[model samples]
Target chain A: MSIFVDGNTTIVLQGATGSEGSFWAQHMIEMGARVVAAVTPGKEGQKLHGVPVFHSVRRAHAQHAAKAAMLFVPPRFARDAVLEALDAGIPRVVTIADGIPLHDQIQIRAAARAEGAQVVGGNTSGVISPGKSMVGMFPYWIERVYRPGSIGVMTRSGSLTNEVTAWVVDAGFGVSTLVGVGGDLVPGSRFAEFLPAFETDPETQAVVIVGELGGTMEEEVAEAIRDGVFTKPVVAFLGGRTAPSGKRMGHAGAIATGSSGTVAGKVKELEGAGALVADRPCRVGELLARVVQ
Target chain B: MRLLEYQGKAVFKEAGIMVPAARVVRASENQALRDEACAAARELMSAAGIGRQAEQDPTGSSGGETAWFAPGVMVKAQVTSGGRGKAGLIVRAESPEDAGQAAVAIVEREPSVRVILLEQMVDSACELYLSISTDAGSARHLILASAVGGVEIETLAEQNPTAIQRVSVDPFMGLQPYQTRGLGYDLGFSGELVKRFAQVTSSLYQVFRANDTELAEINPLFVTQDGSLIAGDSKLIIDDNSLNRQPQFEVTREQYGTDTEYEAALEGIPYVQFDGDISLMCAGAGLTTTVYDLVQFEGGTVANYLEFGGPNYRKARRAMELCLKNRSSVILIVTFGTIARADVMAEGIVGAIAELKPDRPIVTCIRGTNEEAATETLADAGIEPLLDTEEAVRRAVAIAKGEQV
Candidate 1:
C-alpha cells in the first residue's frame, strides 16, 4: 500500500553475477524481498547462492515471474539491460549505475512511461519499505526504527537514507515506506511520480522529502504540492547550502545548474507551497513530529 | 559535467564527423598555442565563410575577430561542464584581447587559472542541439535532437516536448546513420546542412557511446550561410562513474580537481569548495551541510571542505581541533541524522579548546545518539553546548564579528 513495490514483489537482478550485484542481492533477500532470478548474459545456467541464472532477461522471464528488476550492470550494458527487462514485461526497473548518456536516459524514461512501468534509478541505492523490503546495501542491522508506521520518506541521497531513517526512528516514529530514487542525472522517477503514491497510501499520513541542490526537481515538487494533489502535511529539507563550495550537494540531480536549482530557491518554493521546509536535514523529523502531533 | 566546444569538436572529429580544422589552447606558456589558434581561426573563418564573407566583411574578418580577438574568430570558454553560457561561464568576445580578458575573468571566477576554449566563430542560418545517452527502461542508447537549441533547451522541451525528437539505438548494431538521419527528418532537418548535422549528431552519439559517457551535447549547432555546418558551442558532462573506461577524460578531470572530489564522494564524505573564515568539523553530510547553511544564513563564511571524518569521539575531536586552528570567527560543530557519539566528541572538543589558546568561540548543537558521558564531561569542563543549529550559528557569527558570545 506504500508505493510501487509491495511485499509481494518478486525481483530479479540483471547483473547478479558481479560482486556488487551479489552483495545487494543478498541484502534484498535478507530484507525479505523475493530474489527470483539473476541475469548475466554469458553466465546463463549458472546459479549463485541458489538463485537461477539466465543468459538474457527473456529466459529469466520464462523461468521465474520477475515483476521488478534491480540493475547493477555497468554503464556499457545498462541501456541493453534496461530495455531487455522492459521488453520482457517486467514493469518495475531500478538501476544503480550512473553516467550513461542523458539521451539514453530520456529514451529509457519515455519508453518506461509508455509501458505503464516505473524505473527507479541509474545511480541510486534502490527502494525500501521500512522493516520489510530493502534493495541495495543499507545496514538494516543498525536501523531498528522502521517498525512500520505512517511516515513516507523519499531521498535522492542513497547513503543518507540510513541516517535519515535512523532520525525518523529515534524521534519515536516509523516509516511506512522509504524510497531512494537514484541521484544520477538521469534517474528514473522524480518526486512528481512518487508523490501520488504517498498521497494515495492510507497508512502514509505525512511525507519527509530529503532533497539536494542542482536540479529543478525540488521546485517541481513544490509546485505539485502547491497544486494541492497531496493533502498530507509535507516536511522537506534541501541539503546543499552548507555544501562545501564546489562540492556536489549529495546528488547529480541536486546540482544547482540554473537559477531554479539553488537551495534558497528550493526552500522559498517549498515554503511558498505551504511545506514546512526545514533549514537543514536535521530539522526534517522534528518538524514532522510537531505536525503529526 | 561540462566540456568545451572544442572538446565536443574533438569528439566529433574523432568520430569522423566533419568540423573546421581546429587548434585547442592546451598550453598557456607556449606561444605556439596562440599561433596555432590564430592560424586555425583564419583557416576556419575563410572556409566556413568562403562564399558569405565576401558580402559581410569586405576587409575579410568575420564574427568581429579583428583587433580585439584573433582575427576572424569566436571566443568560447572551454569548461569541463554544461550550461556554461547560461551560467555566464562563457562569452563571445570581439578580439583576442577581449577573448583573453574574458578567459581571465572565467579563470578568475574559477579557483584556478586554467586554459579556456576559444574558437573561430561561424556564421550560421540556424542553431540546434543534438545529444545521445543511455535509455534505461528501453535498454537502448538514445539520440535526442531539438531544432530549438541553446541554454533554453530545457524550457523548450517543457513548453513544446514534441519539437524534440528521440531515437532508440541498439548497442550491438551500434547507432545507425539512417536512424540518426531519420531523427533529423522527424525533427524537420531538411536543408543543405541536414546531412552534415545528421553526421555530426551520429558522430556525437558515437563518441558518447565510445567513451561510455553519461551525456554529450552539441548546443548552438550552427548551419552556416554556406553549405557548411559547424558545432557552434558545446557542453559535455561525462560520467565520473565511467572514468576508468575513459582515461583521457579522466585525466582532464584530474587537471580540474574533479578526481579528488569524485574520490571523496565515493568515500561517503561530501565535499564543497568555500571561501570563508571558518573550517567546520562535524559528523555526517546532513550536519555539515546544515552547519554550512546556518553559517551562511547567519552571515558567517566557510573555508574549504573539512569533515569531522569519523564517528569515533577521539578522531572526531581531533578533527575538530585541526579545523579550529584555522582563522575562523568560531569553530562550530553540529550533527543531525544519527549523531553517533557526537556529544562525547563535543566534550572532547570543549576539553581541547579549553587547553588551547582559542581565539574563536566554540559553538555546537549535537543532537541524536546517547552521549550522556560526553554531555556531562563537556558541561563540567565549563563549555555550554547549544542545542539548536540556528542558535549555535547565531552565537558563532556574533562571536566572529567581534561580539561577546
Candidate 2:
C-alpha cells in the first residue's frame, strides 16, 4: 500500500563498485530491496553483494529488467547517470550526490519529465517504504523511528527528517512511505509532486512534510492543497524561520532571498491552504494528531 | 562565487564580447607598487588618446555648437558586492591623476576594496540590461532583457513588470538564435542592431556555459553614439560546485563571508556565524536551522550554525573545535543520524573534548544508528546525552542566559 518502492520493485545500483554505492547496496538488500543488477563502467561481470554488474544501465536493464535505479555517482556525473537511467526506460531513479551543478539538474529534470518518470534527488538521502523496501541511505533498522504505519512522510533534509519522524513515532504513529526530495536549488521532483501518490495510498492516513526555506517547493505544496489536488490531512514543519537574508545556511538551497522563500511566507501560505504548520520539529507529532484525528 | 567586476570583464572579453578599453590598478601599501599603478593608469589614459594636446580644438568649440571636451574615464572599485555607485565607489575622472586620486579615495574609504578598474567611458546613447541566469523554480536557464537598465532589475520588475522580458531556455537546447532575435526585437531593437544584440547575447551565453556561471549579467549593455554595442558592466557568478572544472577562477578565503566560513569550507562543513551566545552543531542544514529557530523561539540567539553529517560526519571533531572558537557561553549538539552514524559523531565529539577541555556548558541530543554506543561514549566522557531536541535547546538557552539547570 506504500508509494514509490516496495518489496516487488527490482532496483539497479549505479556506481555499484564505489565505496558508498557498495555500502548502501548491501544495506538496501538487507532491508528487502531487490538489488537485481549493478552498473559501473569497465566493471562488468563483477558482482556487488550477489547482484549482477554491467557496464551500462541499458545493459543492466536488459539483463535484469530493473524497474528503478539508485545512483551513487558523484555530482559531476549525476546528470549523465540519471539520463542514462531514464534512457533505459527505468520508471524511477534516485540520485544521492550533493553539489550537482544547477544546469545539470535542469537537464535531468527535463529528461525525467520527458520520459514521464520520477527522479528523487541530487542531494537526497533517498526514499524508504518501511517493512516493504528501502531504496535510499536511510537506517531503516531503527524501529523507534521507522516502524511501518499509516503516516506518509516527505522531506528536504535527511537528518532533520530522522529527528522529526522520531517524534512522529513517539506520538504513536509510524510511516507508510518516506520520500527525501533533496535539498537543492532544483530537485528532480518537488514536494507537491508526491502528494497524489500519498493521497491514493489507502495505508496513508496523513502526510508529514519536513520543509525548509529556499525554493518554491513548499509553496507548490500549498497550491496543491488549496486546489484540492491533495485531499488529506497534512502537517508540515518548516526550518530557517530566523535565517538572515542572502546567507546560505548549510544547504545550497536553504537561504532566504528578497521577500520570497521566507519561513514566515511559507507558513502563512501553507496555513491559508488548510494545512497545519508546526512551529517546531517536536510539535509536528502534536500537529499530526490534531489534523489526522 | 561572485566574481569582481574586473574578473567578470575578463571572462566577457575571453568570450569575444565587446568591452571598453580598461586597465586595472591594485591598491597597495607599498610605495613602489603605488607608483607603478599610477604609471599604468597614466599609460592607459594616454593610450586612449586622452589629454593629447594636438586633438584639442584651440577655440574649444565646433562652429556654433557647444564646447567639446574629452570623455572622462570611469574609475570603479573592483568589489564583489553591488551598490558601488550609491556607495561612491564609482567615480568619473578627467585625467589620469584624477583617476589615481579617485582610486586612492575609494580604497581608503572602503577597506575591503583592494583593486580598481580604470576604463575609457563609452559615448552611450542608450543603456540596456541583459543577463542569463538560472531559474530554480522552472528548472531552466532564463534570459532576461530590459530596455531600462543602469538600475536594479528587481526594482524595475516591481515598478513596471513589462519593462523586463524573460525567456526561459531549455538546457538541452541552449540560447537559440531565434530566441535571441526575438528577445532583441522585444527589447525595441530593429535592423542590424538586433543582430548585434543577438551576437552579444550569444557570446554572453557562451561565457555563462563555459564558466559554469549561475549568473552572467551586463547591467548596462551600452549602445554607443555610433550604434555599436559594448558591455558597460559585467557580473558573473560561477557556481561554487563547478569551481573544480573552472580552473581559471581561483577562490580565496577573503571571498567567503568570514574567515571562519572559509575555514569550514575547507573541511567540507557548512558554518555560518551569528551574533549570539549559544553555539549550535547539528547533523544537517535543515536541522541546524530548525534548532536555530527553536533557540530563538525560546528567547536565545545562536552564535553560529554548523552542520556536519553525511560525508562530513567524520569531521565532527574539527567542527566541534570550530564551535569552541566562537564566543558562545554554551554549545548545543543536536543530531539524529540516519545515513550519518551516531557513534561516529559521538566519537568525534568525545575526541574534540578530550583534546580541548573548555569551561562552557555542552548539551547534546544524539540518536540514530548504534545509539547505545554513542550514549555510552558520551556517558564515559561525563556528558549525559538528552534524547529530546526541544529539551536540549531549552537547557542550552537557559544555560546561556545564566539560569539554573
TM-score of each: 0.68, 0.91
**Model 2, which residues run further than 4 Å from truth?**
B30-44, B49-70, B91-109
Model 2: DockQ vs. true structure: 0.71
Writing each residue's lDDT as its tens digit, candidate 2 over A183-255 gives 8878899899899999899999999999999878889999999999999998999999988887888777887
Q: Each candidate: fraction of true contacts kept?
A: 0.19, 0.72
Evaluate model 2: give its lDDT: 0.84
Q: Model 2 over residues B190-238: C-alpha lDDT tens digits? A: 9988988888889999988888888899999887654567788998988
* Number of backbone collisions per candidate: 33, 0
TM-score of chain B of each: 0.65, 0.85
**Model 1: per-residue Cα lDDT over B158-252, one tens digit each:** 68888888887765567777886777778776764567666676668767777667667777666656545556655566665565556776344
TM-score for predicted model 1 compared with the true structure: 0.68
Output DockQ, candidate 1. 0.22
The local lDDT score (0 to 100) that residue B110 gets in candidate 2 is 83
DockQ for every model comes to 0.22, 0.71
Q: How close is candidate 2 to the true structure, as a TM-score?
A: 0.91
lDDT of 1 at A195: 87
